[model samples]
Target: MKARVHVMLKDGVLDPQGQAVAHALGTLGFQGVGEVRQGKVIDLDLAATDRATAEAQVREMCEKLLANTVIERYDIEIG
Candidate 1:
């Protein structure tokens, strides 16, 4: 089984890194790019065969170590 976790900041939070990227893009002549948010994707290979269990485990991983729940939200995808 494979699990993919996406971690991102919640809205109404200040994202200096995202704003930096948007500024750099404009400097490079890219236009119409407004409000860019940065996030991360974590791909995991699990030995568990059950879909529910795998999702649970991955969600635990995100809550425990992968994501900063205080300022971010995460989504889990199992395959």
Candidate 2:
């Protein structure tokens, strides 16, 4: 099974790194750049036989180590 995990900051959280990227884009002549938020995607090949089990494990990984649950949100897709 393959699992793709996406981790991102929750709404209302300040994203300074994203803001820096936005500013750089604007300086490079990109217009209408409103806001930017950075996130991470983790792709893994698992030995689990089913999507349900992989999904649960990925969710647990995010909650325990991949992300800071206090200010971030994560979603998992299994295939």
How does each model score on lDDT?
0.95, 0.91
lDDT of 2 by residue, 15-37 (tens): 99899999999999999999899
Which portions of model 2 show Cα errors greater than 4 Å?
Answer: none
TM-score of each: 0.96, 0.95
- Lowest lDDT 10-residue stretch of candidate 2: 51-60
Relative to the true structure, candidate 2 reaches a TM of 0.95
Q: How far in Å is the alpha carbon of 33 misplaced in model 1? A: 0.6
lDDT by residue (4-76, candidate 1, tens digit) is 9999998888989999999999999998999999999999999999999999999899999999999999999
Q: In model 1, where do residues sit more than 4 Å from their true spots?
A: none
Q: Superpose all Cα atoms of candidate 2 onto the true structure and report the RMSD in Å to 1 decimal.
A: 0.7
